[model samples]
Target: GDVCVNTLKQDWSPTHGIRHILMVIRCLLIEPFPESALNEEASRLLMEDFEEYARRAKLMTSIHAASASSASKKKATPLSVDVANHLVASSPKSSKKEK
Candidate 1:
């Protein structure tokens, strides 16, 4: 995924490459491929039916924004639970090591 982002930054050096890259990125954002995916499912959805894909993308974006806002409200300060757990588990053990 990071490599793909880097690839997008590079010059396409070919006609219509920019357009194709944009299409692919759009697909990746909505329907990410964590595994080895030849092409993203979102792109196929878009190519098959643009209208439906756009509608769903818009809805998802709105829902994501709302959830982000909700989460932001719940977080009031620093020192997360993960940090506390790490500090507790990472202490030295007072035990002799056996060879």
Candidate 2:
């Protein structure tokens, strides 16, 4: 994960807002970070056989897209303030120490 998205990284800063975080996520989706991949097999496939990896990723995207479209058609519920606050609080903080 990128520093902006991974709060545990020393490079991470509390100053980064949602816009910056989303941009980093979009960049990651466009070009994955295989070096820090949680799925070793997928990462190895991506590095060793890019064509096959792309084919599989496309297939999975289409499959999930169809499901997501149907799910989105249903009424969405707004996040409660408590849940939102909890999520913000639970997020990891940067490990950097200030002098």
Candidate 3:
């Protein structure tokens, strides 16, 4: 079950706080509900070949982890003041006059 679509949106309640939400997410990860799966192919693979599914999941996790580490190492350069000002000035909202 999807956290956003199933839990947060559909099964959302005042009683279900952050802790409850987290627990639900944890449960889903531990034991996935294939019936309401967003990715049918993954669900099918998981159902058909558990070993293959596990292997692919591990591979994807490692790939993502490597990319994430590399991304963290690269610092984002801040936009120059001149470019920021130009962007603001060029916006459609900036062109509109309020009478």
Candidate number of the best lDDT? 3
- Candidate 3 residues 38-83, lDDT tens each? 8887889899998988899899888666576687899664432233
Instruction: Identify the runs in model 1 with alpha carbons over 4 angstroms from their true place.
Output: 1-3, 6-39, 66-99
Lowest lDDT sum, 10 consecutive residues, model 2, at 83-92
> What number of backbone clashes does candidate 1 have, counting pairs of residues 3 or more apart or in separate chains?
0
Listing every candidate in turn, what is its Cα RMSD in Å to the true structure after a full C-alpha superposition? 15.1, 11.5, 12.7
Winner on TM-score between 1 and 3 is 3
> lDDT of all the models against the reference?
0.55, 0.65, 0.69
Output the worst ten-in-a-row residue range by lDDT, candidate 3. 80-89
Q: Kindly list the per-residue Cα lDDT of model 1 for residues 1-99, writing each as its tens digit.
A: 243543455654444344466666888766665343444665576677778878987997886666766877884433222322321222234233547
Report the candidate with higher lDDT, 1 versus 2: 2
State the lDDT at 57 in candidate 1.
Answer: 74
Off by over 4 Å in 3: 1-5, 66-99
Candidate 2 has what TM-score?
0.56
lDDT of 2 by residue, 26-83 (tens): 8877888888777777789899999988898899888666586688899754432232
Please provide TM-scores, in order, for all candidate models, with all chains considered together: 0.31, 0.56, 0.58
